[model samples]
Target: MLLNLNKMNDVKKTFDTINKIVADWDPLGVGETIAEDEYAGYIPEIIQVMKNDQSLFEYLSQILANELGRGFDSTDMKHVEGLKSICDKIIRAYMDI
Candidate 1:
């Protein structure tokens, strides 16, 4: 049971770290204009994609574009592109756990 507890703790830690990363990105500008947790709803999905070793960039881009209620364009692409680093950060963080 100790091992299971440790795994649970690691998962919680990863979730918290990724949550912060997503909030920092503030895809909806909510951190500055609205609330900090505005993007909290998307974190679980992001984590799932990350854990599954899926295409984080593509998944994030789609989520961002959908939330912004617009078609994926150059500007939007560029904005989301900035978030690509978070993917690496998350991977490193997860590995460390």
Candidate 2:
């Protein structure tokens, strides 16, 4: 449809503008390419965390505890406080902070 094409073109232009801006404005060139081992090591934990119904931090902590041979109760207040720290770390890592 003509309307669909126009909408697509508008979106394409917007994306082009954004790309140009980012190309001009990157402050950090970027970090080291993530190593395969690093990613592989986190795979199981990331998957378990994704599968959890609890908050992401609590979920990640639980996964870590399991990996470290410790029993952690996600519902406990101490773990919940730990979850807050985990949350900060996660958000910071993703630049969502």
Residue 84 displacement (Å), model 1: 2.2
**Model 2, CA-based lDDT:** 0.46
Q: Write candidate 2's Cα lDDT for 1-97 as tens digits.
A: 9999998886555444333332332212332342322224443444335333355556556545765444567579986675565555443433321
TM-score of each: 0.71, 0.37
lDDT of 1 at 8: 93
Best by TM-score: 1
TM-score of 2: 0.37
Q: lDDT per residue, candidate 1, 1-97, as tens digits?
A: 9999999998778777777766776656666445346766777777777754347767776875786664456466666556566677767766776
Return model 1's CA RMSD, one decimal: 3.2
Q: List the residue pairs that clash in candidate 2.
A: none
Cα distance off (Å), candidate 1, residue 8:
1.1
